[model samples]
Target: MSGTVLVTSRSFGSGGLDLERRISDAGFHVVRAGAAHELDELGPVLGDAVGWIAGTGPVTERHLSLAPHLRVVARYGVGYDKVDVDAAARRGIVVTNTPGANTSAVAEHTVALLLAALRGIPAADRRVRRGDWSAWYTREVSALTVGVVGLGRIGRSVIDRLAGFGPRVLGADPWVPADDPLFDRLERSDADAFATECDVVTLHAPGGQTVVDERWLAASDRPVLLVNTARADLIDEAAVAAALRRGRVLAYAADTLATENHGEGASPLLADDLADRVIVTPHLAAQTREGVDGMGGMATENLLAVLSGEPPVNPVPVP
Candidate 1:
């Protein structure tokens, strides 16, 4: 467990490389690679590695089998969906992720998206840039009802931040207890019901398929403003596009997309339609300076702990 560490990272700005240097200074040989596109190339390089600081790479069972000396795989961010946790667990290699490190940043970004959508910030900015500045229009934040999906750490932070906005915040989390103070006015209902009732709907749900489908979009009683700072798969892309076309959704803002690594000619969500009403940030909700340092520190600590035969701080379930 004292060998060199392989860092299979996605494309990060120069700042990420600086962080890797810091890790190297901490007495671990860091073998840095851009991406995991060449698993064949990675196999030999990572053969003797004891720890891995991973990014959004496809670390499958086959990839795990290549590194018999690997004891830990520490993901950069909260989502470890791209990594094969079960495979790592089977090989007794602990998989860890930085969970709460980026919660505040994400929560703030979620609020930004919500405010941008509700107050027409993007539209107004575009209009002003084009010499079309008119007098400020009247808008009321208190008048809008905001609904939060998945009341986890980020969700709770969102709720806490939104408390001062004067909007009634409703939540829909099946896991939350009925008597919990967070669920004061929150309801344990379906996504459709939540969609139908709220003027602004912010998503904090995990990545998967069909969390927000055509049916949920169709069930909306009014033109809803959708903000998803969470995973892209929480909302169906095609359904959201259709919703935008028909005015079912007034506006939409997202920090993540269904396909992040969309190769040449790939259709990303809201890429074709460059409407001012929609705000799409390249998956950077948790890319703040503090977030990066915290995530890197936590991930490094987790890798160190696992390699030292201790439990990881945020262990992902394997098989």
Candidate 2:
């Protein structure tokens, strides 16, 4: 309770919740560090830190080894793949994430990217700035067959918003029960089935494996607009770029790049020719004010709970 509370998440307390003030009021000194969570930079503070509000950085065994007093690691976002949970668990440290906190924000961003790619919004804006005002035809959402890859909280929210568009929504989630209410309204299909039926395919699957590759694109019977607001590893960037070149993928819109955290030099999706068909954002899908507040509040609460000898609301199970 008297030691420092280390905060490595860049956007941890930037929300309306004033999470830093709350932590400070609990008699713990709050310390800030880089989102990268470098060993040298965090070594000094880790020794005195009781709780760590981590970002999308790796919390390896090396990091846990440095912090003898560390009791909990509250991930500031829903995804915790970057964190080394086994190391924390071995050290008797609780790991928690703000699940469903940014669901609405990310879902809205997914739909926005879909619309942007569909209507060529960025390209049109660029043309207008250069004084070219030629009109181009675009397909309406109501006319396209949209396929969603995951049916989790954010995926369900995306479907709910897409309902207003009146598109033929096809859902794909092997994890979800077949009797789930979502399948009642939409046809349940797999990602492979989407290639032949869907005009637009948005990815919401969990990361760790490549879902979209050259083989998947080559199986397509028509051009498909691909949107990914989930993870960078979800799609094979090189394959996607190739598909775009061949017109198999009409457009590729995503909120992340494989080399985004470092540099995008290796990604073929950023090539000059593919710029017309590729749209990439800097992983800001869950950076809305409301989303930030929800994530910050939940993370802060989790950290405080563990430090106060109470169980966290959202503890991640050790696998």
Candidate 3:
């Protein structure tokens, strides 16, 4: 009860202050570790903390080695790519991630991006303001074949939303169980087949893997509409821009980028020539009130469980 719980994530309490109060009311001292991206900066705090609610930082073995009393690391969100799971497991540290918490929000955003990219919503709005609306024709969502890369929770949610649009949704993910109910409504496709056959390609795979690279885009018969709401690492931006310029890719809509903190004119996709073909959001797909609250609650529960010497509600499975 006297041990300190270090909350390294700046966003852990951002959903609401009630969760933070709950941690304080539990007779445990809560401290902020200031993003904690660097192990050395957090070394002073990690040396004594028994629990660490981690953010999107690199939790390397060196960091784990520094945390002698660290029993658990409750990741703030779904992806734990930054956290070294094998290294933590080797040291008997529990790691948990909040799955399905941001599924609905991200799925909704994916559909929004689809509509925006296909309908030219943003461009048409600008034209209307400038007093010039000659003609505009966009692709219809109902007619296109959408190829979803991963069939995880968020991927399945995207398909669920796409169902009402009457689009032919093809899912490709070896991780999905054969008996999953989604198979009844969704058709299976291999990675290459999905890239070649589908009119639109949307990525929902995990991080640390590039599913939408030059090779993946090269197989497509036509300029494909590519959407990515999953992770930045899923796509190669330079390759996407090159394809977009050469008319090999129709458009790209994404809620993620190679890096979050980009200065003025930093990304290649920001060029004026590709402006009409690329639409990017500032990673706000899963920042909805409902999504944030769900993530916070789940992360808090995970921390409590590990602190009490019990298993987390959603522990990330080790391979």
Candidate 4:
């Protein structure tokens, strides 16, 4: 418990160097390496390490077998789909994530994408650059009803921001209590029901292909606006593109896509017809300076807590 803590980072920017420094200053030896190579290298030092701050590396049972001294794993962000939690739990390793650390940053970015899609910001910018400055306003946020798919930390924050914009907010999360003050009204119905009732549907759920295929889009009553800043697999990209082409969806702004980490090089939703109607951003909802610093600090704190033989601030359940 008094030795080095291996930190496997996956293509983190130079800001990660500062996080390494903070870990070192906290009186623990740090072993920093890129995730691509670290999975192979972890076997060598796993016996000496007390904790690990993992990025998007594959922490399989094979890698876990080497870490007899490992106590906890602190993920850099909220998403833990990349890590094998069941394997870690079987070995008594506690996995933790920095949940609310990047809530405001991601929520703000989600709203920004929503507004950008609704107001045609990208198209308008391109038009202005092409020397066309005709005064035009298509749709307003106030004129639309927003359906929030998940009412978690980021979802609630987005709902709070949307409240100021005067848009009717409908939430669709069974995990949240019906009497919660965060939502104007909770829709116990499925995603299709929420999609049919709202003009704009924003996603804030964790990873998974929850809303798959064109059935959800086809079920909507109008050309809905889809905003996803959470995970790419929540919606079907091909189905969404088809909906956009058929005029069933007015626009879509996604910061994440199912093919993002698939190494496919191009998005399935980036078709020529859907390009102008879509706003696709890399998975950068938590890339703000403030969010980065907060995530780094919280990750370091979680690792340090495990090293000190205390419960982590955000421990991932052993299941």
lDDT against the true structure, per candidate, is 0.78, 0.91, 0.84, 0.78
Q: Which TM-score value belongs to model 1? A: 0.88
lDDT of 1 by residue, 1-319 (tens): 3478887655232344366665566667878775543686687867888888887656788888889898888898887877888888888889899899889989999998888877888878888999997856635768888888888899999988988878877888777777888666455554567767888888887665456788888778898889999877788877887788788888889997666653435433555564766888877788787777778778888888887778878888765
> Which one wins on lDDT?
2
Q: In order, what is each prediction's RMSD in angstroms?
A: 2.8, 1.5, 2.3, 2.9
List pairs with backbone clashes in candidate 1: none
Model 2 lDDT, residue 34, Cα: 87
Q: Per-residue lDDT for 209 in model 2?
A: 70
- Stretches of candidate 1 off by over 4 Å are 9-22, 35-44, 134-139, 185-188, 271-274
lDDT tens readout by residue for model 4, 63-178: 78888988888888877876789999988898889888789999999999998998898988988999999767678788888888887889889988887888877887878776
What is candidate 4's local distance difference test score?
A: 0.78
Model 3's alpha-carbon lDDT is: 0.84
lDDT for position 143 in model 1: 85
Error of 1 at 275 (Å): 2.3
Name the lDDT value of residue 40 in candidate 4: 55
Candidate 3 structure, TM-score to reference: 0.91
Flag regions of model 2 displaced more than 4 Å: 264-266
